[model samples]
Target chain A: MTEPAEPHAHQHESLPVAARVRRLEERVIAAGLTTDAEIDELLTRFYADAAPVNGARIVARAWTDEEYRDRLLADGSAAAAELGFGPQTSGFQLRAVANTPGRHNVIVCTLCSCYPLSLLGPSPSWYRSLAYRSQAVREPRAVLAGFGLDLPATTRIDVWDSTSEIRYLVVPVRPAGTDGLRPDELAALVTRNGLIGTAAV
Target chain B: MKFPPGSRVRARTTDPGHHTRLPRYLRGHTGEVVAVATPEPLPDDVARGVPEPRVEPVYAVRFHGADLWGCETGGHRHG
Candidate 1:
């Protein structure tokens, strides 16, 4: 594991762009300048004012409608358009990936938390923690175990570590006996961790 | 040209500039591109302290759970 450098010593102008950025981020996290609740408050305000809620509605509708789910998986942006999302500004394509018993899914941002806020709402602090990001790629089993997600030895562990160019979100499989649930009810089951593949409904 | 929506692509090693969205863990990892977001101007507030409009397209990708964390030696199945 790379030891975190002394924050004060790494100047943005001296280091490579990536390293500089990383060091700055590390400093912020190390300083504990932003509390989790404050971050959540920011996200809450951002989503409340932005189009994320609309995206979540689209996801919930798809959860209840199989045809919509097929369409969403086929053409995410188009399906999102059907629900009055992504028409002009804040252009984001929404895709929904189902996590079944056989195949599980998890998401991580190796860079920063480039989450799909449009559909999943705010990201949790753990999702942005250096511990989670670093450990996620190196020792996924141990990390998931910490999350109480113990997979069988046979299951292939595919980790999607995000880069600046791309982001990711997991569409946890709807819990059993939720076949007849409404969109609003299904939304309640979609926890933030569930969207990242750490927990399930 | 706009690639087909949901088309999966790997990041080229030569892409320039600051890339904060990509995680260090998945630098060379592979996954399916889930969606493409609208192009937005890069914010100057990035840790790099550079303020330039980005030309790269943003995407959402999916990775399998088992692919991330290895299967346990002798634990019960978890999804």
Candidate 2:
């Protein structure tokens, strides 16, 4: 195999975004502006508040109620606030997309992994990869199939490219055999991938 | 038009020196608006670290696979 081309300072092939973020964190620590404890605490709080559990809860609530579902489809951020997911400090916006028998929705930020971070916590590393960014829109059927979600060929896929500030949360179809499950139990079925439209709940 | 559902729009193709949210694959693609999204900060402003963010409307646009690829790509398998 031919050796890879030599990377230059201007080329980011040598230092990816993750490495840059880590280096920036090191500088902040080295500057003595904040301690690791504070950073860890903030990160913990962020994850706890914005994890997939929050999206699951929202989906479960929508599954159990019709009005809330309408509101969620109309204005995701406001409906999220009704369930105590208040407006984020950074003023991020969330939009909800529901899956129906005729259509399936998927999301991707091909520009740089711009996600519903306030609702979904940190995006998965897979979501940030260039493969996902470009292919999610170009070949959504194959991408979803790789994620273990085998939708029939009849289903029309609508790939939502988030090329702006609006972030999307997918409302996966409520699976069968869940007739007696409570809302929280139903929530337990929803995964981050489900909310991202890569997997079904 | 405000890009209401089913409204036709063409993605503007322009590579600038500043940060942008428009992806390369979608630069010249044509799509139809599916929904009107909440306004939020422009990606370039967010990247520049503006203290007060300027908000803009975001629309969910859907492009047809056949229109994008110029062929019937149904049975095409991906690697």
Best by TM-score: 2
Poorest 10 consecutive residues by lDDT, candidate 1 chain B: B70-79
B42-67 per-residue lDDT for model 1 (tens digits): 44235466565556555555543344
Per residue, candidate 1 scores C-alpha lDDT tens digits across A57-141 of 6557777888988887766667766776664213444445566676666776655565666556665666766677666666666
Model 2 chain B poorest 10 in a row by lDDT: B70-79
The best candidate in terms of DockQ: 2
TM-score of chain A of 2: 0.84
Off by over 4 Å in 2: A1-27, A87-90, B45-55, B71-79
> Model 1, residue A187: displacement in angstroms?
2.4
Model 1 ranges off by over 4 Å: A1-45, A49-56, A87-91, A163-166, B1-79
TM-score of 2: 0.82
CAPRI quality of model 1 = incorrect
True contacts kept of each: 0.16, 0.16
* lDDT, candidate 2, A50-122, per-residue tens: 7888889999999999999999999888999898888552465677889887778888776666688777778
For B39-65, candidate 2 gives per-residue lDDT tens digits of 667667899898887777776676677
